[model samples]
Each structure stands twice: as structure tokens, then as C-alpha cells.
Target: MSRTTATIDPAELKAAGTARQTDSSAPNADRPRRRFNWGKVFAWAVMIALLIITVFPFYWMLRTSLTSNSALYANDMSLLPTDFDLGGFARVFGLQSPEEAIAQGGSGASIDFWRYLLNSVVVATAITVCQVFFSAMAAYAFSRLHWRGRDFVFSLFLLSLMVPLIYTLLPNFLLIRDLGLIDTLLGIMLPSLFMTPFAIFFLRQFFMNVPTEIEEAALIDGAGKIRIFFRLIIPMTVGPITTVAILTYMNAWNDYLWPLMVSYTDDSRVLTVALGNFTEQTPQTGPDWAGLMAATLVAALPMLLLFLFFARRIVNSIGFSGIK
Candidate 1:
């Protein structure tokens, strides 16, 4: 029994020694095989930095809007609102500015904020509809359909784009006045925005990028130019078209200078002009920092939300489409 026990103890000791050796060797084996990757970590850091930079402005704006007027004026400007209040938003949503509208006519008479809202809606909608229709048709002509001097005409339009808006401002104003469209929504919207060259060009490039085989197949099936455009081309490029429409709607909605110049009457005003009206208020009457900022936020909120929602699709379209 002692002899058997001595043999068993040696075997156990040998096994334990082998196990220890295996265990110690395991980590050493992995050490040579393991690769330290900094590329992924660097890429992640870059993305996080970009995200912070991109979203910071919007976060600041939200915090500022929620902050009280006195708190906003604190010596230490902060990312956080010192005193959070919603009264600024409330004042902005108030339909009538008593100082401008009600006072101008008196208590019984009210200035029409609703009218300005309606005006913005009408002008933006009409311009969007017209611009889309016109731009699409023009793009189709330049892309799929052939006409005389098409390249030359397109180049001229491109050159026109380089001319600064300031250069044509006077001419456009004079033209609007001559047409007696001054103080009218039509006057404010017609001159430059009704049919934008940029929109046409953007749509045209996307249209060209479309599979020519599809268009050819439609043509062989006895489809006309208009039919091919509506059925095949339009469906394929819906992303870019959506981007264009949103841009057009935003431009018309936020138009400040032209609307202020052409439309004076409360009957035909838009939100931008109305917001500016808040800034012109004398502090002796009552400073409206809260109200003014609120109105600006309200005006910008829609566009910001729109871009946020559609950013993915817009980016996809631009990535897929090209200038050539």
C-alpha cells in the first residue's frame, strides 16, 4: 500500500507541474498573437468630435431659449440655463403684438398675425409647386430631350448663378415696382425664386445619373418624353427631388429682405418680417429679448427639424449623384 501510494503521489505531482507549465505558457502565446489597434480608436474619436461640434450649436440655442433673460445676461456664459422658463415661448406664440398692430389701429382692431402665417404658407407653397414643375420640366429638356443650343442656354444659366444677388437686387425691385406687384406676395416671390436655376441644375444632374437603359426601354415601349419623365425618371430620383423641394420651401418661408421690401401691409406680411418687427421695438416701451429670441427659434425650428429628418436621404442622393 505504501509503495502504491508513493507511485500515485509522483504521478499527481508530475500532472500538476504540466498543468502549471501549460497555464503559464498560455498568456505568453497570446501576447505575440495579439495586435493593438489604434485605427479604430482614432476613427471613433474623430466621429465623436465631429458629432459634438455639429450638435453643439443647436444645443446652445435650445438652452438659451429656455433660459430667463436675466440669467442669459450672467457674467459667466454657460451651456446650462441658470433659470429655465417657458414664458419667452409663450410671448412669441402670442398672435398680436399690441405695440405694433393693436395700438396702430386701437383696441377693437387687431393686427393679423394669422394673415402673415397664411401669407407665408401661400407664397411658399406656390413657389414650391411652380419651381418643382418648372425645374423638373427644364431638367427633362436638358437631360433626356434634345433641343437647339441646349448646352449654350444651360451655360448662360450657370453663369447667371455667379452674379451676386446684391447686383440684381435693385433691378428686381424696380421690376417688381413697375409691375405694380409691390406690397404683394407675388412681387416678393416671383423674381428669383419662382424658377431657380440651381434647382433645375441639381435635378438635371440627378436625372442624367439615372440609368439611360430604363429611359430607352420606356421610349421603345411607345412612352413619350413626359411619360418617361413622370414614370421612370421621377421615381428613381425622388431623394434629390425631396431635398430640392424642402430647400425651396425653406427659402421661401425664411425670406426676409425681399418680403420686407415688397410687402408692407399687415395683410401680406410673413414671419421673418414679423420677427424683425420685434427687434425694432424701443426698450422704453418694453425690451423683448425673450419674445424676439422665441420668435426666431419658432421660425428656425421647422427648417432645422426638416433637415434633421431628411439629412440621411439628402446625403444619400448627393453621394449617388454627380455634377457631370
Candidate 2:
């Protein structure tokens, strides 16, 4: 008989709902605030310091190149070029006359900058091409092919990596001399043109990771080893190949000692060797700091650009190419 239910106000219900939502939205009083992390701050500070230390030298080189040779001694410690001039670059490219160069405190000796640049390009390109190709072939053989005494042969090849590069210079020089290739670009190219132990090892690591099932399928299809390598394995491993080529090219481009020992004249003299001679050309005073820095900056620009362009690829490929 008593079925009466108490009536509730919609307005009260709405207000209660609003209050609950407001309470829920409020910040938590019991939550702890984050404290400043000195460790992270210290790490960032250290990294910035190292960045400045590493980059200041290049900035100084740019400053020296921009400053006039006559004023370099006066403003030796200036952060910015006090006597700003582009004549150092002019001197580098042989645009300044001997009298003009000397008046500007240069050595007045021509750099043969174009000739040396050409020689460097030729030698480096030749070495990168030949070395990468041969090394990739050798790596394919070692990693993919089954043959008697393969591991032993690879071990012997790896042992060569332990040999000091300087120890072989005399022998290589003698061999080039006997071949009558001294003072020639061919002589410079011949030594590193075939392959390097490190190159083989690097490529072998990548080659070993290629799935064997794909190769077995190619074999079933009557594809030969050469065809399979060219068509299948190579296409699958472009990243490592590119990394290797970039590294090999940079090494060949920057090589100084071998080029210095083999070539004496402008015929095969590389930029590095030319720069060394350039330092001695102005013996009366000191090295033509302005012009020398300008030339050096020019010489190093290529590798810098190369690394900048392919840096991401190299970094990303190395992790995947390593022992798996």
C-alpha cells in the first residue's frame, strides 16, 4: 500500500554533478613536484663544452683564412678577423700574382691547386671503385660460398689487418719503382685499388646476414652464383655497400704519406702533399698561415660535405651490419 518514492530535484542533481566534475578536474595535492636534475644538467653542460672545443678549431681556421696574412700576427688572438680579406682564398687559387702575394705576406709560390685537386679526385675515385668491388666479391666468396680451406684463407687475410701500414710502405714503394710507375697517378692508385682487409671484413659481416633461403631458391631456379650475387645479394645490401664506399673514398682522399712518398712532381701530387710543400715554400717567415688555411679548408670541404650528406646512412647501417 506504501509505494511512495521521494522526489529528487533535477537542479540539485545537475549542481552535484558539476561539483563532482570540478573536484575531479582539480590538481592532486598529494602528488610530489619534480626536483631539478643536476645529473642531466651536468651532462648537457659537458656536451656543450665538448661541442665548443671540437668546433672552435674549425672556426679559428675560418677566421685565419679570412684575415689578411700581414695582420694575422697583429691580431693573432682575435676571435673575429680584424683585417678581413678574401685574398687568402685568391692566393690559394693562384689568382693573386707573385708580387701581389708577396706584398700580402704570401710565399709567392704557385700552388697548382687545380692540378692537385684533379689528382686527388682521380686517385680517390679509382681506389673507392676498385677496392669496394673487389672487396665485395671477396666478401661474397667468404660468406656465401662453400669451399675447401675458405675459413683458413679468410683468417690469413684478416691477419694482414694486424700489419702496420708503415711497414709495408717501403716494400710498396720499391715495387712501384720497379714497375716504373713512380711519380704517376697509377702508382698511387695501384696500391689500394684492389682491396683492403678491413673492407672485406666489413662487407663479409653484412653478407653473412643475408637469408640463405633466398639464395637456395635462386639456385633452384638455375641461377648461377655470379648471377645470384649481382641480382639478389647486392640489391639487398645497398646500405652497407654505400657506407663502405663513402669510408673508402674518404680514406683515399685524405691519404698523405703514400702520395708524398710516391709522387714528387705536380704530375701525381695530391692536395695533402701539395699542402705540405706549400708550408715549406715560405720558409723565410713561417707557413703562409692565411693562404695555407684557405687551401686546407678548400681541401677538407669535400669530405665534410660527403660526411654530412651520408652521415645518417652510415650511422644507421653500422648497427645492422655488425655480427648477427
Candidate 3:
């Protein structure tokens, strides 16, 4: 040190470094949540609005169904029923007609309403059972069994699905007439009591979801195809199968056109066709709007209850089926 300055020492530098303990440019670790975002709020609002829009029709149908015809036709429509009468229900049960028991349709019979109901139940039950089983078996074969031109066959089935059902109406009628199944349950069921391309398609997708390993294990245990299917697959896929059953039941129960063509007798008429006839024949008596609504509600109740009961399982099965 030639020119002895009052040396600003290295110790001072170290002391300065200590004073300036490294500061962070980042935001504080502990801060309260930010204010509500308008964008997020709006998104939620839109979703709620869409849900209401989607659910409105069902609400309207229920409201109208519950409301009396007089109240229904009032100058101003009500979102809710005012009188809230179970008169409609009473009419459906046919209890009030006890004026010395006016025997409807002679032969001392208590009207044919129950007969029609029984016919509907029998026919719809038959269709649902046959269709579900047939569809499941066909779906299993398609999904698991490898064969020549399998995809081609599947493609052809899909093509059938694309064809408008109306296109087959004439042919179906002709076939029904030829088989002398016309005006009979066999005729009604003839059109497609045991087969549907859509059902096969719906179930095939679900069968694909089951693990190959589980099926292989069953095979290794010397289980046959039918045994494996009933024991392992069917049990595992109950949700989807139930969904199919529900859909099939609804379709069969609500069917009107084919039933109308075939079911001409009191012995064969289904509830839907009977209801239509009830509306059509303005015979001396006036339109029983309350009774009509009541009957419609009765016709609709089982599937509605079913859907409500299995809604969660239905949604889950639909998601798992890979149709989406």
C-alpha cells in the first residue's frame, strides 16, 4: 500500500452484505383470497340457466298432468296447480261410477280398462325380455367372437340403424299379414320383438369395457362361453343391462302404431291404443280430459319411477358404455 488511504476494509463489505439479507421479488406467501371473479360468476350463472332450460319441458308436462283440465284451459296458465285435485286419479281408478253399478260393455264386466292394462303389461314385458336377451347375446358374440367379416356384419347392422323405421313399415305390414300374425300379439311382436340394431350396438360397447383378463381367467377355469357370460359378465354389467331393460320397457310400453295396426280386439288392445280409441270415439259422452290425463299418467308412471330410481346408475353405465 504505497499511498496509505483510510482503507474501506473487506470486513465492512461483509457487514454490508449481512445488513442486506437477500430480498425476494415474489409476492407474499400468506395473502387472503382475491375478490370474486365476474367471469367465473357468469359461467356458473350460464350453467344454471342451461340446466333450467333443459328441465323446463319435464316440469311443464308434470304441471299440466297434475292440473285439472278446467284449470289447464283457464285464461292465464299457472306454473303451479291451484285446486290440486285427485279427481283425475279417482276417475282413473273408476270408483265414482257407482250409480247402481252401471255395468260398462255388458256381460256384467267392470269395463275393459284393466283388460287393456293386462294386455299392455303382457306384451311390453314380452318385448322387453326377448329384446334384452337377444340384444345381449348378439352383442356378446360380436364383441368377443372373432370371425371372418365381423366388422362388415357390424357395419351392415349399423346401416340398418341408419335406415328410417318408416321405410320398413310396408314390408313389416306385408310380412305380418302373410304370417297371419296380423291383429295379434305375435304380429305386433313380429316387427321386432326380439331384435334391435340399436340395442345390439348399445350392449356391444358395454361388453367391450369388461377386461379381457377376467374373461380369460374364466376360460382357463374350463368355463364355457354361456357359463362365463352368465357368471362373470352379466353380473358385472348389471347397471348397463338394467339400463337396457328400462329403455326396452319404455319403448315397448309406449308403442302405438304397430299395436294399433295389429291389436283390434278388446282381448289384444294395449293401453296406448285403448287410450287413443278413448280419445277418438266421441260417442254420446264428452271428452274425459281428467280421465285421459290420469290414464296417460298411469301409462307413463312405471318408467318414470324406474328412471328416478336408477338415474345415478343409468348415468354411470352410459358413461362406461363408451357410446359417448
Candidate 4:
């Protein structure tokens, strides 16, 4: 006997297909779209408020820099500049002669602005370069090299982070004095030139995250540890390297106490120290508030520009380094 097959009805098949489609689409048809979250709105409001609070001082400094001396000390607080004045800036840059500066209602002190600025640039650049390079080498050894007592050594190094900079300042000053580097840019940069614990820790975390296979392959290709580090590891970690450089540069640039302690003369003084001295010793007139604000703005400009330019890379590297 031959076996027979039964065929389905077209109408029944069509109805079943329609039912399945309706069932699949039911959730979409019945579900409501999400409305904007009020919690998010509140959170953003708080953030904006905090941002304004944090940035208000810089804004005030810039505003005061543009305000005339009379406008700056006027009873009424004007958030915006009433009369735009360049005398403060001129005084800061030594653009006006003492006689002319005094004639223009400015403190007649001649600040060697360019000299201090150059000193800052040289010291900050040297510190950033040396610190980043040395920290990177230390990080490579800690992350990749096998050695006895490495962990213990690294732990001891981390302990340095706990020691306050104030505690070391006197000893560091004595050492610099012994070297006869006082009143020199080299003295200002010497403390930071070697390596910072934070920099090594930051870089080592990134270095550890690098794939071991890359180093192994480099080794198989007859590349030594130093060659592998320079070629393979460094090339892969530009983000972290640049992040450390920016950070180190910012620190060295903004450093006030150390530079002030080491350098007193205009020839060797950095921008921060110069600005502080200028503020304190304005001519027979009271503190030159507008000129001081102008000088402060000029000194802070580089760090602001640096952060604005490299902020994204800095944030990414910090996140990648597994630091909170």
C-alpha cells in the first residue's frame, strides 16, 4: 500500500501567520515610550551649578584683569568690565615705561614678565620630559621585568606617596643648597626630575594592561627588553604617556612654594613667584589689584590651554589605568 500525505489549507495557514505576527507586535503596540527623567534634569542642574561655582574665580580674575583700577575697587561689584583697560596688562608685560605706567594710573613697577615666563617654560618642559621618561622606564621594569623582591620594592615605592611633600621640603631644600643650585631654574626642577611615585604607578597600571603576547613575540624576534619597551610597549601606550606628560607639565608649571623657596631673584624666579611678589610689592599705591589679576591670568593661561587641548586623552588614560 502507498502512503499518502495530507496538505494544509491556505486559509488556515494564512490565519495562523497573521496570529503569530499580531502576537509578536502586541508588546510594541501596547508599550508606552519613556518620558524625560526629572531625576536626570535635577542631576544636570546640580552639575551646572557646581561647574559655575568652580569656574567663577577664573572668570572673576579675567574680568578684573580687564577692569580699570578705579572700577576694580569701586563700591559696586560689577561682574562685567565697566571700562576696558590695557594698563594692567601693559604694566605686567613691562610694555609701558615707569613714568608712562604711573601716568596711566598703573603701578610703576617694572616686572620682567618675559624673563619669568621663559624660566617657567624651561623648568616645566625639563621636568615633564625627565619625569615622564624616567617614570616610563621604571614602570616597564615593574610591569614586565622579572626580578627578586620586585613586589616588595614597588610596595616601598608606593609608600612614598603617603609622605607629605611638606615633610620632604626642608631636606630637599638642603640638598639643593648643598648643590649650590639655589636661585636657579635647575633648583626649581630638581626635586621633580627624577621620578614621581604617582607617575610610575599610573604608567605601570597601563603597562600591565598591555598584552603579554606582544612582548613574547618581540622576544622571539630577538628584540631585547629595552628594545621591546621602546618599540612595542611605548608605541601602544601613547595615550598614557601623553597624559603623564601633561600632568607633569601642569604640576611643574603651577608649582609655587618650591620655586619660591629656591629662587628669589628676578633672573631665576618662575612666573608664580614673580606674580606673587608683584602683588605684594606694588608701588607706593595700594596693591595693584587689576595688574595682579592680569598677571595671574597670564600665568594661568598655559595650563588652561593645555588642559583644554589634551583633556580627552587625559581622561581616557586615567580611566584605562584602572584608577578611580
Among the numbered candidates, top lDDT falls to 2
Q: How do all models score by TM-score?
A: 0.72, 0.84, 0.71, 0.83
Instruction: Please identify which of the two predictions, 2 or 3, would achieve the higher TM-score against the true structure.
Output: 2
After superposition, candidate 1 runs with Cα above 4 Å error: 1-57, 67-84, 95-113, 316-324
Better of 1 and 4 by lDDT: 4
- lDDT per residue, candidate 3, 227-275, as tens digits? 9778987898887788888877878888888788777788788888987
Residue-level error in angstroms, candidate 2, position 32: 13
Which runs in model 4 stand beyond 4 Å of their true positions? 1-45, 316-324
Single out the weakest 10-residue window by summed lDDT for candidate 4.
30-39
- Model 4 TM-score, 2 decimals: 0.83
**Candidate 2, 111-173: lDDT as tens digits:** 789999999999999999999999999999999999999989999998998899999999999
Q: What is the lDDT of residue 130 in candidate 3?
A: 90
**Model 3 misplaced stretches (Cα beyond 4 Å):** 1-87, 98-111, 283-285, 315-324
The TM-score between candidate 3 and the true structure equals 0.71
Clashing pairs in 4: none
**lDDT agreement of model 2 with the native:** 0.86
